[model samples]
Target: MRTPLGGNNLTAQQYESYPSADDTWTVSFNNSAGTSGTYEVYAVCLPATQAP
Candidate 1:
């Protein structure tokens, strides 16, 4: 799931899936304007199946 970090002030583009045994994911962001600032990140887990 991709979402914005901070309303309009700051934001995150998207969440990506990394190679892992379990259902794991990652998200990243950077200051495009080149201004010092702070933001928050949130994550959650959804029902999924594990391949054999």
Candidate 2:
């Protein structure tokens, strides 16, 4: 998490995964200060043949 001001007080409160062919995770964050920022998440995808 990147906060423009008021310091970085981002915490991952909870995480959940969905049941599907493609796995996906949902993350919840707690920012008590309500600071303006961007929350970014990334996932790695590999082809069936490339994955071991």
lDDT of 1 at 37: 55
Q: Give one digit per residue, the lDDT tens place, for model 2 in 1-52.
A: 3334445665443354333456764545665656556666555666567556
Cα lDDT of candidate 2 equals: 0.52
Per residue, candidate 1 scores C-alpha lDDT tens digits across 1-52 of 4334554554334445453446555555655655455555556667789999
Which lDDT values do the candidates have, in the order given? 0.52, 0.52
Instruction: Candidate 2: give the clashing pairs.
Output: none
Q: What are the per-model C-alpha RMSD values against the true structure?
A: 5.1, 4.7
Off by more than 4 A, model 1 = 1-24, 49-52
- Candidate 2, residue 45: Cα displacement in angstroms equals 0.4
Off by over 4 Å in 2: 1-6, 17-36, 50-52
